[model samples]
Target: MEKVELLEAVQKEEENIIRWRRHFHRYPEVGFEVENTANYIAEHLEEWGLEVAKNVGRTGVVGFLKGGEGKTIALRADMDALPITETKETDYQSENIGKMHACAHDGHMAILLGVAKVMAFHRKFLKGSIKFIFQPAEEGPSPGGAAPMIDESVLEGVDYIFGAHLHSLYPVGTAGINLTNMMASTDNFSIEMIGKGGHAGLPHESIDAIALVFRMYQEIQLMVSRNNDPLEPLVISVGTVNGGVATNVIADKAVLTGTVRTQSKNIREKIIQQLEDKANFISESEGGRCNVQIERGLPPLVNHESSSLMVKNAATKVLGKEKVFILEKPNMGAEDFAYYLEEVPGAFYWIGAGNKEKGMDYVMHHPQFDFDEKALINGTKIFIQTLMDVWN
Candidate 1:
């Protein structure tokens, strides 16, 4: 089918897509706990007569559609929500307390379901097969969801993969395409300081674990600034610190939890080692014991050159050339889709969902984040056009 015709078809089904998205948004779940979401997706796919696989990688749902069959292409969508509570006063505001679809995974799922509908109807005309991936926990409770899905063999036999995220940074009706790195690698670390506790009034009697914790935090900042290359971008953020039962007592133990982000694997590894070493040295000098735990999370998301070119060409064929913008720099945000890219050649891109006039300009994961409904049609058209282009 032609691009305009495919877009028109998606437009006709806009009401159903919105209905599905709101239903998902009303009952959001976090991380690997997406039981209802997975069931809903599997139910719909089964109704569409596609081969459905449930629980591929802990609540992940996969669907398969076969046609003339040259090579298989995978279309992926994340199926997890954030832990933020909804503050937006809409008819479909989240019904579950302390959980919300603030990151637009609801929109991503809707777009993929729309693609399934269109592709299912026109399966006879397809030159190859299509795999629909409903991935759980892109936002990650720890290492991330993509690695688990990859371990489950989700990318096997897949020639190319495609995925997209809703972005509030760009204006509505616009899309971003990148040929190189699109996002950074994320790693987490925790430092624990152990020392003797005593009365605050007697400074000499206490080992002062709090003091050591502060010193370690400060030294980490210096390491990022002075030790690393000035041209490279690196960030070390200490998000949480807990210690001390009372203000009058010196804490016996202190815990520090934080995140580190880097663009390259080598930089990430070096920063991690330096962080551990600095923490241990500072604690030892202060007469305290130190323990550091470093956990590697998702790798940087790098879009292949040829795959990105295919995405751009498909987008241009669907929407005009004026609507597609090539990104200049990689974002520091992390995506679990990087795991899939590690196994196969693929492209992940951004679909604009910001419109100030409609009060939809809030960033992803914000309490009041929302997307323009027009983005649903735009995303659906792009996926359909891209699949047809790739197979042809």
Candidate 2:
């Protein structure tokens, strides 16, 4: 079908897509424990005449639609929400307590479902296979759902893959895509400081673990500033510091947890090595001991130029050339979609979901975050058009 007809088909499903979004939004699940969410997705995919597999990555679902013999292409949608209670006063406000679809995952699943239904309807005329991946735990517990799904050989025969996010940064009708280095790698570290405790009145009797943590924090910021190149993008953020029980008694131990963001692997490794070295060096020199642990995360999201161009072309066709934009810089936020790009040629683009006129421009992960529902139709159209571009 032509792009216009494809867009019209998606428009016809806008109501259904919004209905699916509201259903997922009402009962949000978090992390790898998305049982109801996974079941719901699998049921619909199976109903659509697709070969559905549930619990691939513990809580992930995959739907396989075989078209004519050709390379297999995959489209992914994350199926997890945040651990926040909804404060939005909408009718579809989260029915589950302490869990909300603050991020656009709800909308993402809806858009991908719209694409799946439309593409499956044209299955007989398709030139390639379509794999619909419903991933869980994107908001995450280390490694995330993408890695687990990849470990289960989810990308086994996939030739090209595509994923999209409903972004609040752009207006309601524009799309932003990147050709290279779309997002940074997110890594975390923890530091433990041990010292001797004493009464607060006795100045010379105890070694201060909190003091040592302060020094280590300074060194971390300094390392990022002085040890690394200025042009390279790197962020070492100290997120949590826990220590001391009483104000009168000196603390014996302190723990600090922080995150690292970097666009280059070499830079990421270099920063981590320096962090461990400086932390231990400073702690031991001050009559205290420090232990640093590292948790590696997703790699940088880099889009293939050809695949990204396909996305841009599709966005232009669907939303008009004036509405499609090339992002000037990469995002500091991390996404597990990076994992998929690492395995196959693919592109991850942002769809404009913000609508300032309707006050629907809240930043993602906020309690009142939501997007213009019209963006759903535009997103599905882009996904379908991109598929047509790739398959043809």
Error of 2 at 159 (Å): 0.6
In model 2, how many backbone clashes occur? 0
lDDT by residue (164-210, candidate 2, tens digit) is 99987678889999888899999999999898988999958998899
lDDT of 1 by residue, 19-111 (tens): 889999999989999999999999998998899999988889999998775779999999999989889999999999899998889999999
Candidate 2 Cα errors over 4 Å, as ranges? 1-4, 198-206, 245-251
Task: Report the Cα lDDT for candidate 2.
Answer: 0.89
The TM-scores, one per candidate, come to 0.92, 0.94
The stretch of ten residues in a row with the least summed lDDT in candidate 2 is 1-10
Residue-level error in angstroms, candidate 2, position 362: 0.6
Q: C-alpha displacement of 71 in model 2, angstroms?
A: 2.5
Which candidate achieves the best lDDT against the true structure? 2
